[model samples]
Target: MAGILVVNERYFPDDELEPAQVGATSFSRSALRCLWNAGLSAGVILYKRAEELTEPQIDLTHRSGFRCATLRFNFDMGADTVSRAIAEAAARLCAAYGFSSRAMLYYQTDALLVFHPQELACCVTHHGPFVHDFVETFSARETAQAFGDAAKALHLFKHQELGVNSVRSNGRMFVLQHSQLQREYLISRGVDERRIRAIRPPIAPPTVSEPLRDERLRSFVEGAELLVFTAVARLDYFKNVELLVSGCVQARKQGVPLRILVVGDSAEDDVARQALRAHVPEELSAEFMAVGKLTKSQLYALFSLARSNGIFVCPSRYETLGITPLEAALSGVCTLMTDSEKVEARRFFPDAHRFLPSGDGLADAIGLAYASPSGVEQLGKELREAIATEISEENFERDTLSAWSYFSQSARQLDS
Candidate 1:
């Protein structure tokens, strides 16, 4: 069996473990597990660093302005400590592993992969240029050079795979286009397109065969008289929680007594909870409950409840492929997501307009969902049947095996 090394930068202390960290770690672990289950042998290398940067490895990789910004964000003048110790440590680990000679790097984010060209054979990434091309985050020169190096490295480097999980399109481009564009842009900068592959993100089946529910959740679902607008996401800009809250308020204004359950923690330290409290009208805010991070059992319970009730909504600004909707579909829950014409969600559902659209159309969609709760049930039935046909352990195994076959062949070619 061929061996693969997976490198990740996000390692949390038991006490410091938060939802974002948990989510990132879970994604990384799941991807690794998928690789392993596909029959490829793999190991994980975690980074622990004390300093963010010991030396500037490549000055040409970043523009002067971008370098200053990176320094500002990553270095503490008062403490003289680098905030990016994790990324720096990841670089060291990659170098130590002689990644260029043997292993491929499956990166959680672009930041960790940027500074370590010499240590990697190829990189598999989720997000595209948004993170790497940030003016506030890195210098243009740095961004330019990183792309340039990544492209050059591609010829000798091995492969670069882009894993996109969601399918949505907006503002004249589909979400998948971002990955395609990134690949194209890298190719324009001299990376070989043949080395690039786009893989749809996979969802892991539920761990438990049976669903578990707590008394609070049981009571909440049992007593619900009106529609339940449900959304679960790590509170982040991409999630667009405020839009959901606002949409809920609008739904209530239109005489829909909708109760929304928001799972996951807000980044702004209870800012979402507070905003719902003060900004949302009394009835709407009263109907809103922001339950922070939940255990897997609790989440499954929510899924079960939503499945039974037929009301799930994801109003993300951008989604590569929203996994929650698939989970909801598997649970027999009807879901409404933002209309991104390019995403697989609509393709998966087909009855796309039933879900809300981004911006102004959300409130109307929520109101519509309230008016026709049974519509969600019917949709759920359709989804359940469709998912039963499409997503099975057998198919997952097949696809995973195919991915492994490709990986192994690539490994052999590199070895040759």
Candidate 2:
């Protein structure tokens, strides 16, 4: 077997991703560690679609004890052409890093930018297809929010079709689906079941981080009968911000006294933030307030406050094993998530706070936390214990490495 090469299109070396908010980068980071532990060399290959760079640029650099190679190209090309370009880039990186032609390539993002698996020993992890969010939140997305146009939506849909086509595209290529719903979807799209592995995203207990301190947030929590903490990495349409506000409206009408502390920024889609605020009535404006981006430490500090009077809520239309809910559960806050089979929470988390993705359902779920605070607290403890007992760092690492090894070893067999 040769070394491993991890590739993710969204990964940029310069960006700082909070550990709690990002699971893809962490999984790639952990893959490097696991490979090193097995006495094999490993490196990361970042591929991105950049229309601004004008010219394609691919370079290698050593960063933070890891060998990193980056490829930046434009996205307007044909799907087959883009996939071929990425595969060629990985082949070149493998040779430069002293890996054989058949080096194991772990494609981290479901961008499905690489389809020529026969030319590369690959295992594509379907984090999610861009089209999933595009269609799910179509009505909610405003023209400025990136998915409102017919051309772009069709563009995403086209690639999603091609991307799913590669689930069983090659004999040597294996696929990993992060959620069961995604796996079923792929199967429905004619992907071979033999090549796909279903693995939920791993959850680890969060380390202590600084508490989020804001005077405005402090005052709101002070007057709240129940505190609901929500962490939005980006206030995008798929995050379903309107749904959150609408649910709060329903709850407030029923006289459910609560305050939702939202920590995130709408920098990616300011329109989403604007639309969310518009959905709120003046009477219940304080019921839901978004306190923009906070540091990791500050978020933990916020999570700690929830141990007594708070719970975490994820109101996403499409979620691929979101790390926030699990992290909050570990912090002893009952983590509530929108009920969807595609969500990992539905499979792993307790049903105590699971809510239908609607106004009345979301409101009722919040009411459950408000009416039986102790029950919510106990659910948090139970979730923490159950996940901790079943999926530890050691076990998660082992399972990840084993999946790669199984595919890599198969590639070697075919070569022999």
Candidate 3:
């Protein structure tokens, strides 16, 4: 089989991936889905934690359209463990997939594990090792790390010396960055800007089985000429609900008739949400509403109702996809986001919408939008159209296949 060897860090059946598993889960699924559509026979290598597997062994699981190779290793223990597992798994996967020893073409969801020349893959940048620790999804990592210019210079130098997943891109490899900020980061690190493509993953369209049944929300929407700003995230430090609180307070003081509706809670408990509620001043209580978590359909219906005068805000301290804003755009609401460097999806919005990740900055952004209602609403419509076109399934399949073809061609040329 002269097909690509598709790989990812996690395992989820191609069609049955969950919403919580969005970033890493979807990365390889999109590639495998496109490769299958192209009539390519590929093997998927899924990496899981060492503890999850009973023993350290490679299991070849056959799926509907492709072969899967599951390899387990304690990635926390560092590169040696990962290298051994990948080396063993790659050998078996190459042999099983009929990939010639001379040319091994990989379509990696994250082109991070390159113990071989299989580094020439169409890789998604958001999941790449270069920015993994920086994204900081966990509260423990929220304090921040020393990401000075020298943040990855030593790391990249080590990888370059080992000829493993080097960011010093040659013309042979393809890197799809989720945002222009990421592309700029790569360019600064010596990748050619021409070879770098920026495209955010499409948020899967919401499927609503639940109806919008909240009377409180209905009355709020029906009340005065209110601008509904929705923010969705588990109530946690990483989500930065503090920024939302501060921003909402400022927006109201500036006479912007706005209602802040938050859509998620800390998955385990409402402690964080309660803390957030208490953090809001007593007088501002009526304006800020945490409607609690709603099902997919209910949420979208809520957005649809508020679409006329709605704006979605993501004030996360750091994020990769910024899914809420994307979903909001799909529901015909414009997006206001924190720094582009913090949330990759911020790249899709104009400068007016991408605010500094601070309370005052957010208030100013909201003030600007309130000042020009018609323009902001029209911009919402334009953004909705742009997201539909730019992040469509058709475009993802096309881009994935195109990169696969490019990598395949380059690998064969090397073999020749």
Report, for every candidate in turn, its global Cα lDDT versus the true structure: 0.49, 0.66, 0.60
Candidates' RMSD to native:
10.7, 3.8, 5.7
**Tens digits of per-residue lDDT for model 1 on 249-333?**
7666777666777766643467655654565676455566676655545566677666655467777654545666666666676
Predicted candidate 1: what Cα RMSD to the true structure? 10.7
Stretches of candidate 3 off by over 4 Å are: 1-17, 41-43, 51-55, 62-67, 75-124, 128-174, 191-200, 203-239, 264-266, 269-271, 286-302, 317-321, 339-343, 367-379, 386-389
lDDT of 2 by residue, 1-416 (tens): 45555555454344343433344655565556777677665566777668887555677766546667777777665556665655666666667667665566677754553445456667777664456543554453442254546677676667767666665566776776666666766777677787776554555555765554676776676667777668866666656766777787788788877776666663354555665677878877757777565555566677776766776888876666676676677777777788876465566666766899898999998887777746666767776776666555676666766776777777777787
Best-to-worst lDDT order: 2, 3, 1
Give per-model TM-scores: 0.67, 0.83, 0.71
Model 1 stretches with alpha carbons more than 4 Å out: 1-23, 52-103, 114-120, 127-129, 132-191, 205-214, 266-268, 341-347, 353-360, 373-375, 387-397
How far in Å is the alpha carbon of 317 misplaced in model 3?
4.4
User: Could you tell me the TM-score of candidate 2?
Assistant: 0.83
